[model samples]
Target: MPNAIRRYVRFIDRTNEIVGLIMMYMIFLMIGILLYSSIMKTVAIPPLWTLEMAQFVMVTYYMVGGGWALKNDAHVRMDLIYANWQPRTKALIDTVTVLFLIFYLCLLLYGGFSSTSYALKYGETSYSAWSPYMAPVKIIMCFGIALTLLQAVAQLFKDIAIARGEEIS
Candidate 1:
């Protein structure tokens, strides 16, 4: 990889790591909050933000965590045919699949950018009590899409190297 791309990949790695950490933290926080809310409600405290926070945390956890999932090759995939193929043949299939996903993610990034732009332009905010600006969160979808795209490119290069009988390790 070129220096710039290597740097970008490093950035992606850092971003993926941070996102994973945040997701884990969010999960723990949500679980703790729910427990607290349950206890408080039993005492008539009635935690109001629990429902909204849980919903937002779920979104944050999933969207932010996806790049890390892709980075670690943790996404669920069916490889019945590829499993029987030779390494070189499997590399080819993997390369093609990564390319396809690149196209798909590119579309997502484009649409996300447009939607976020519209939201920001309109000063859109959540209708709920918190009234958090929705644009920032909408933009995160684009960041995730971009990270996935980067990962796809890295995978494409890796697969090509493997198909050429190069030892990737």
Candidate 2:
């Protein structure tokens, strides 16, 4: 890989690493919030926003965490078959799948961004009693999808390089 492309890849990888760390810590935060909510409920002082807040946080965690998972190659797959493939064959299969994923994620990103824009334009909010504005969450969802798409593109490049016997690292 050229220095510039390699640098861009490194930057993306590092950014996703930070995102993954945030997601990891958010897991702890979610657990703490839920536990506190449960304890408070036992004492008859249940927080009305606890469930809704948890849902938002959990969704954000999953959204932003997805790209990190892909970066680490942690997403589940049919390893029984994949592990038996040759290197070029593996690259080919990954190329096909990543192309499909890129298309799907592009659509998702468009939808997410459009919904977020609409929510902001119209002041959309959750119907729950807490009634948090939907725009922020939608924006975050879009950001996550964008990151996932970026990672998918980077992976596609690498897969292509491998298939062509070109050096990537």
Q: Give the per-residue Cα lDDT of candidate 1 at 113.
A: 91
Model 1: per-residue lDDT, tens digit, 1-169?
4465556566776778777777778788778878888988898866667777777667777777877887777899887776789999988889898888999988888899999999999999888876777887787767767767776776776678789887432
Task: List the pairs of residues colliding in candidate 1.
Answer: none
User: Least lDDT summed over 10 consecutive residues: which range in candidate 1?
Assistant: 1-10
Local distance difference test, each candidate: 0.77, 0.88
> What TM-score number comes out for model 2?
0.94
What does candidate 1 score in Cα RMSD to the true structure?
A: 2.7
Global local distance difference test of model 2: 0.88
lDDT of 2 at 154: 82
Q: For model 1, what is the alpha-carbon lDDT of residue 125?
A: 82
Q: lDDT per residue, candidate 2, 1-169, as tens digits?
A: 6777777677888889888888889888888889989999999889888998888889889999988999899898879989999899999999999999999999999899889999999999999888889998898899889999988888887888788887565
